[model samples]
Target: MTLAAPTPTVPLNGDFWHTPLYTRTVDDGPAVNDALHALVLDRTRTAPTSTVGVRNADKTSSDLLRWEHPAIDHLRGWITDAAWALNDHVGAGRTPSGQDAEMIAEAWAVVYRPDGIHQLHSHHDAAWSGVYYVSTGHMQEGTGLLQFVDPRPSAAAREPDRTPLYTIRPEPGLLVAFPAWLRHWVTPYQGDAERVVVAFNVGFSRS
Candidate 1:
């Protein structure tokens, strides 16, 4: 397999210490999405819902991306490289050797039908976790948005709008990764179509 090049990562917040949010938008949106649609649909046939999050949606195990498919392979590689780029960006200098880098990667897929929602949770054992949007679905306001909570228990509370809770609207091909411990959840999806997402995590190889 050819080694995939790393895409430029954008820092959502300048203050890396406060709440680091890294994002990258892949260019191969059409092909990857087409492939993902079939891959997810086929997997759900046998897997059904794994009962992970608090939602009325189709969820698979963390090993869903392990299958041998072009798009799945591309994502697996893309995310691994992205994690390395993030490490280098943070000055950790951890193995940024492209495809040759050592890392523990796991990913799962979720298909949220209308009114599907997931509860708040965090990837407790991962270094960096991300949510990749394959299909944003036809959503209205405040639907299918990824919401992240402030880790600080008490900083400063603002009225009118919840200052502690930040949100990112879903976009196809968008890959947003953040600290593993940042607790987050998705708002109930009220879309007419399916909202497809791939949730992934990466950590140093424990060799």
Candidate 2:
């Protein structure tokens, strides 16, 4: 018997990061936003400082709670599917051994402002990292563009002055994935509306 031809696959790279963002445009986005706002308000009421970290001018980061909320579970599932699709395309049947690609991490939300922005940094203990834009209110300026810096700037010795970096404009329902080791940051928002996004950090597990 003759073997069938293999199906063609798309190449995985930085360009594809935002090209096909995993999206879910539910009519209840506003409702979900309200719910999230309530949760954040409640959390902040008692322990005003429960929300830690810099670049949080009206922003907050919560611990990853995989089983705490239905919305979170839905978001997690979306990320899992996207990650698998990306690995299949890039790995060409090779399984990921790193903790980031294992899909065992928790989920968290970052809710905040027109001026809030995260500084350049990377997740050290996690295996994989991702961000899901919850809302991108109408604005043309700085709606928290997620920026990633190339890991190998020294390789571009010819242009030592130019460090390669990429930026992904925030879009409602958009999801982005990248290696946990990649250095990234969020540009300060200058728009009139606030930017809300959920971030996750995955880990490895035997089960």
Each model's lDDT: 0.77, 0.58
Query: Candidate 1 clash total?
Result: 0
Candidate 2: segments with Cα more than 4 A from true spot: 1-53, 58-64, 90-102, 160-163
Q: Write the per-residue lDDT of candidate 1 for residues 61-80, one digit (tens) a residue.
A: 78866688888877876686
Residue-wise C-alpha lDDT for candidate 2, range 45-73, written one tens digit per residue: 54434344536544434453533666655
Candidate 2: minimum summed lDDT over ten consecutive residues — where?
A: 1-10
Alpha-carbon RMSD of each model? 3.7, 7.5
Error of 1 at 200 (Å): 0.5
Query: For residue 138, what is the lDDT in candidate 1?
Result: 72
